[model samples]
Target: MPIVYRLRQGKKMATNDRVWCICVADYKLFAFFTDCGLMWLDTKHNIWRVVSGDMPRKLYGGAMVEYYGKLAVFWRERISNQKQEKIRCAVIALARVGEEEVRGTIEWSGVVATIPYVCGFLHCLVASD
Candidate 1:
């Protein structure tokens, strides 16, 4: 028989908005909000705490993936004038959870080659290590 599972949202999520990324790890639910960055929702306690530090701002059309038991986020960053009509240049960064830190710190591993402003989707694969 197929099993039916349901997740209940509690008081912790009462004021949370701008939910950008959501993932589950080791039975703990994690959510990354664009406005407030990362937060850990304590399902048992019905509480939430900021994951600490500032996440990349002005992020859009980005992608997040789990690589080798770690999280990796990649986004197209504007490298030129913010107000330029035809601004160019972009960056793809890779970050993972840090160690010995209460709040997870993102360590930018590397970036990908730059590309023109193309409206499409980019996918990444985590190779077996």
Candidate 2:
């Protein structure tokens, strides 16, 4: 059974960040933010920690899902070049939460693949196992 929880508006440790996606894995709450990157919130301790390593710079209208037993984040890359691009770049990135070399720390992996010309809002659904 999954335990129920709620989010109450309060002062955040970090500001100017927009939450895009959230996922629960191994009893831990993970939140993906647009400006702050990925964060691992320790519910038991009531503290939040940011995951290091390669991560998407932005996640405004992205989608996240659990695929192949791992969390996959799909989002569109913001165009920076002023060369009048026709198609936006879409990416599918994967990351797993597990033990780190420091024993109690969490490490984030890098992107898995990058595709071009993908559109629409990304969404994810987990099937009952």
Q: Residues 1-129, candidate 2, lDDT per residue (tens digit)?
A: 222233343443444566777876544566777667777675555655676655555676666654444456655554455422132222233344454311122134344334443445544454777
lDDT per residue (tens digit) for residues 1-129 in model 1: 222122354223234255655655434455655666555665555555565555554335555555544455555655575421222222222233543222454555455645556543456454765
| Top model number, lDDT | 2
Which ranges in model 1 have alpha carbons more than 4 Å from their true place?
Answer: 1-16, 25-27, 79-102
Each candidate's lDDT (Cα)? 0.48, 0.52
What TM-score does model 1 achieve against the real structure? 0.55
Candidate 1 backbone collisions, by pair: none
Residue runs of model 2 more than 4 Å from their true location after superposition: 1-14, 78-119, 125-129
Using TM-score as the measure, which candidate wins? 1
